[model samples]
Target: MTEQVMAAIDGSQFSEGVCDYAAWASRALDAPLTFLHVVDNHPQTAEADLSGNIGLGSREHLLEELAHLDEQRAKVAQEQGRLMLKAASERAVEAGVVEPRTRQRNGTLVETLSELEDETRLVVLGKRGETAHQDSGHLGSNLERVVRSLHRPILMVPATFKRPEKVMIAFDGSKTTRRGVEMLAKSPLFDGIPVHVMIVGAETGDNRSQLDWALTTLHEAGHVAEGEIRAGEVEETLRAYKEQHGIDLVVMGAYGHSRIRHLLVGSTTTAVLRKADMPVLLLR
Candidate 1:
């Protein structure tokens, strides 16, 4: 089956940006594009039962009213999801993706995407999402959760959309970082784009060796790559390199670990995400 770039649209501020980036990925990879909108289901009952206060007839009437209200809510939510998907699909089309497909699902975002992850090569989403629209400080809860649950490559969009011509891969000698090097070597996702492989923090002979190997691998795969071993903080070094070299995208890896370590607390990946103003293509 042909791989498709699946972009999740929640009508967030980043939804249109997601579509624009997704369209770029679709064209760059020569793949089909899919726009997915997930409608979260509302709860039908509270944690504790409250039926004891009403008689049988009254309970029945109340239940009927609640069910009717839920039905109408379902209708409105579905229509809203449809409209969001339509707008996203149109954006993708305008961005150069011909005949993009749109899907509207009902459930939690993670669950819906988990089932459809097999057919998707790239998953695009906003930084936080609709829930975080009010709070600029808080990241998207669904974005963090979905990233943990899915094993596919996720392209996190910033506030604005721009196609990246130069990409940077942060190599830390970890398995995830090495895997990113090899993955790029075998894939055309970053074809024709200049790659800068940087190793931040301590500068040892081993780190130099790793950078040399990465450059070799990238060169073997027909990519124009340069290696640089920087000594500083991960985010700070990356920011300097990105600004100095005009980096358009940052490709980093997440090691296999629990959700808490990957998305919260003291993770370098989280820090990089917070600092980067450009698109980040996260690899696992």
Candidate 2:
């Protein structure tokens, strides 16, 4: 069976852009695209006790009004979710995708995504949501939380991204890196594009063998890939590599070490995502 690419949609403009990107990628890989929307049904904040100033009957009426408003909001959210998925499915068909699926869940985004990860080959989400923080660049609260929590490949779609051409891969000797390499090797997402597989922080003398191994793996998988080794800070090296190669997209492993180590020392994945200017494809 063909792999499936899942995208989270909530009818926001940024989410719509994410749907478009997901459609493009699914078509490129000849995979199915699944659009997901989560209806937030969490309880609303407690109402202020205005009953002190009002009669008992009036207080009951006020509470009923509040409940009615909450119900209306929930209904609106569900309707919007359905509309977003329908529009995304239409776009996928217009883009020539063979089969597309839509799913709506009522729960936390993280839980819904975790449940779908087993069959999802990739997860695409918007950089910012309806309630994003103002200071963050590539990721806001929802995307950040999902990225940190999930152990799957995620493609964070920016609001202003056009079609991607040249692709850059941040390759290191990690299980996540291996998974990324295997996907790129077998998938058509980067088939006809120029791929630069870069290994940062490698010793100059030992770099040749590692590059050769990466190149051999790609070649054996029928991908025309080139490998290079660079020295310096991981994020800086990747930025310079992108500039030199005019990279349109950057793909890398999400986290390298254990969760405890990441929490203590900070993660290179987070650093790169915050600093990189181009679109990012993160593999976990």
**Off by more than 4 A, model 1:** 43-63, 133-137, 256-266
Predicted candidate 2 versus true structure: per-residue lDDT over 42-121, tens digit per residue: 73243565656878868888788878987998899899889888988988788788779999999878889988878888
Quantify all predictions' global Cα lDDT against the true fold. Answer: 0.82, 0.77
The candidate that achieves the highest lDDT relative to the unseen native structure: 1
lDDT of 1: 0.82
lDDT of 2: 0.77
Error of 2 at 263 (Å): 3.8
Off by over 4 Å in 2: 1-3, 43-59, 136-138, 257-260, 264-266
TM-scores of the models, in the given order? 0.88, 0.86
> What root-mean-square deviation over C-alphas does model 2 reach?
3.1
Report how far residue 26 has shifted in candidate 1, in Å. Answer: 0.5
